[model samples]
Target: MDQPVYSAAAPRILIVDSSRNNLAVLARRLGAEGYRVMVAETATTALGELQRVPVDLLIADLALPLMSGTELTRVVRRELAWRDLPVILISGRSEADGVVRALAAGADDVVVKPFHFEVLTARIARLLERSTRVRQLAADNATLDERVVRRAIELGEARDRLKALEAELGRVG
Candidate 1:
């Protein structure tokens, strides 16, 4: 069987923007570059998308309609399954405090509005690569843990058998 093409395989992303025009622009830009863009106009809808499908990356506008992007990022970071999920937050407000707050709130990176598409794509690629590496490491760790448990069980069984043999010799003596 042929393996799936990683580059052709759309990297799924959830984009949260209030303006349909903005969403359209971002979705087109990413989709053109082989991303399967999923747009959500509100935080509630974005969370719903997350429940339905696993996203490789999240690009959220900080000034969402009902809930701020910061809150969404926090929720994703706190959630057990999505905690290590990569996020890039965008905002028109570029004040020092705003940028600092976004970063501190667990945003992998914050991009100010009127940003370059290439820059955004580069950041997304880097974040996704890092996430893949982390996931691989986690899987390796789980495998090692299982091996350790199995070895311990085997050692216990061997020790018990040895004890039984010793008891049999004692009876013979």
Candidate 2:
């Protein structure tokens, strides 16, 4: 879609899957594609990594040993800061059920397992691009907020000065 948004610093992706083999495969693939990969074998570790570093994208597999990807998405979305973060849920379960659950839990997209590396990479790129745009919009909003606040303060000061001058003139009169 949009030209791939290239950055000097590779985008970070947090992959949470209990299967060590799956984690390794995903890490290798993403790393080769220029993404900084972070692996977590459990939901706890994934949440901790999120706290320590804001990841560009999250790819989590349902049917994890202790915690499912759905649960992870719920926790992340509940937190105000991570609510808008893009999540891609991977599952080997029934596609319909898994997709519905992932969406309910706040995943941006869901991918069934037995996926091709190229397909996954394309999806990752799309998510990264979307996230980038969202972040840019947030930055723009913050800039506008700052400007509005500054202007409001300036106007208030000017009004105060005007009132003071009027009081002085009244006394003089």
- On TM-score, the candidate that comes out on top is 1
Q: Which lDDT tens digits does candidate 1 get at residues 1-173? A: 33333364567999999999999989887877778889999989999999899988999998887788998998888888888889999988777787788899899999997889999999999999999999999999999999999999999999999999999999999
lDDT of 2 by residue, 31-144 (tens): 777788899999999999999997889999987777789999999999988988889989886669778988988998888878787898898898889888998999999999
Q: What value does the lDDT take at residue 45 in candidate 2?
A: 96
RMSD of 1: 4.0
Q: RMSD of each candidate?
A: 4.0, 4.3
Work out the TM-score per prediction: 0.92, 0.89
Query: How far off is model 2, as Cα RMSD?
Result: 4.3
Off by over 4 Å in 1: 1-8
